[model samples]
Target: MSETFSDDLIASLPVLRRFALSLCKRGDLADDLVQITAERAFKSRDSYDPATRLDAWLFRILRNAWIDMTRRQKTQGSQIDVVDNPELISIDGRDVVESKISLNQTEEALTNLPDDQRAVLLLVCVEGLSYAEAADTLDVPKGTIMSRLARGRVALAKQLGIKS
Candidate 1:
């Protein structure tokens, strides 16, 4: 790969990791997904179109990788082990506890959303991808993206007890 490609891949890591974590909900698995994405992107560098946005291309790769990982996990009958998160368990102070609780509540609300809505929320809202870009990354129509995002925002607001 050329230096520019390498630089782009490295620059995309933080967003990739965030997106992976949103999909998998485990730091370790998210890291693995990011690694797999980078590897695949590097090996398939020749297939990338230079005219398109690299971040969207990488997001597409990461989303596909997560799908592939989930399919394999299903075939292998894999399940994530649930345990209390340490941040939520902390008793440092009232402020810290409140902050953790608020954060956890938001995350849990996001988690409860349907897979399609959750993916749309993360891609468009959290990752700052335009509707068209998100649609292209997910290989869906722009109308679909807009609809999902609208529904997701309403659902998320309802989950958080916010009037919309």
Candidate 2:
């Protein structure tokens, strides 16, 4: 509605894109997700609680959209790979190449997790939401989120060849 609102939405794009990529693993799909998120947030702007974290709200919308898309496509597996393009590997000035390597490894590990565990892990660990916050976003009890996070971490460690 205002310049500030537009600015905030623009600032959130990168993280939203990254999160969408984690879910969809396709650049085009992730981009479409980001666009859908932006549009939903705009249309339902009045529903946003001023005191609540906008990022969390937007993430909830993105997660719902991802689920809806999955249902529509009847995805048999959780992971979705993007087209192989050299450009997706292009690092910008702010990227740490070594860290990116680690991130790739982590993504692979994440892919090995059950979809439920992966969603909880990403919302809490990668998205930096508190357990309660993540629980709220996923519409589960706090205890459920905690247990899923714990189990997800254990599963990730195993998948990554790290001892738990």
Candidate 3:
């Protein structure tokens, strides 16, 4: 790989992990997904088109890997909770706790969304992909992406008790 391509791949890691976490919900699983995505991207670099965005290509690969993985394993009902770390505690303990609580609530709400809607929301809203890019990444039509995004926004707002 060229140095620039290698650096771009490295820079994309954090965003890749965020999207992986949204898909898998478990940190370890998300890490594995990111690893698989990087490996696949490296091995398939010759197939990449310079015309398209690298990040979008990587997202498509990660989503495919997640699909393949789910087909191989059965998901359990047990959910893992984030353990409190003392290092995170601040001088204003109440404020820290409130922030953590709010974050957890938002995560829980996201976890409750249907997979398609959540994926659409994360790609467009969280990852800052344009609707057409999101559609291409997800292998769906642009109109489908738009409708899913609208429904997802409405559903998420309702869940968070935000007026829409």
Candidate 4:
């Protein structure tokens, strides 16, 4: 069981890093977030309910860690630089460049949206989660998820200059 969990964690690292990157927009911080999440997940392995999706459980940890970091930084008042250590979270350069173009656009548009709408867009559009699954992950009503999804789509369309 321990070996299986270790293997699962290894497999999840890449996706988890991507999700963290989306949250932090910095490679080093995202890598740190993934590392912290892995440590927490390993330490609390027993607390993890097998019935729940492991990815969702991991995401909750990463999100909480990010929130905590942001809160701490409020007092520090200085941004951390993790951009130079790109090797820690290796992304193919060509793919990353292509992704950056779209990500920059999408992320900018996403930032303008309300938090609920941004989360819905990430879960549905980026993470490919179904509306029901997203609602479960977010602990919100399905209708709320749907409304956010609709609003997010409209916002993205307008931001991207789509005449719809």
- Expressed as tens digits, the lDDT of each residue in 79-159 for candidate 4 is 545686655665689998988898798778889988888999998777766677689899999999999999889988899
The list of candidate 3 runs beyond 4 A from truth reads: 75-164
Scored against the true structure, residue 32 in model 3 reaches a CA lDDT of 99
lDDT of 3: 0.88
lDDT scores of the candidates, listed in order: 0.88, 0.84, 0.88, 0.86
Clashes of each: 0, 0, 0, 0
Worst 10 residues of 4 by lDDT: 72-81
Q: What TM-score would every model get versus the actual structure?
A: 0.48, 0.45, 0.45, 0.48
Candidate 3 matches the true fold with a TM-score of 0.45
- The TM-score, computed over Cα atoms with residue i paired to residue i, of candidate 4 is 0.48
RMSD of each: 13.3, 14.3, 13.4, 14.1
Q: What value does the lDDT take at residue 20 in candidate 1?
A: 96
Q: Model 3 over residues 1-164: C-alpha lDDT tens digits?
A: 47777899999999999999999999999999999999999988989887899999999999988886774454333444436455654488898899999889888999999999999999987776667779989999999999999999899889989998
Q: How displaced is residue 39 in candidate 4, in Å?
A: 0.6
Per-residue lDDT of 1-164 in model 1, one digit per residue for the tens? 49999998999999999999999999999999999999989988999999999999999999988886775565566444446444445456988989999989989999999999999999877676667768978999999999999999999999999999
- Model 1 — which ten-residue stretch has the worst lDDT? 78-87
- Residue 2 in model 4: shift from native, Å? 0.9
Instruction: Name the lDDT value of residue 71 in candidate 2.
Output: 59
Worst 10 residues of 2 by lDDT: 75-84
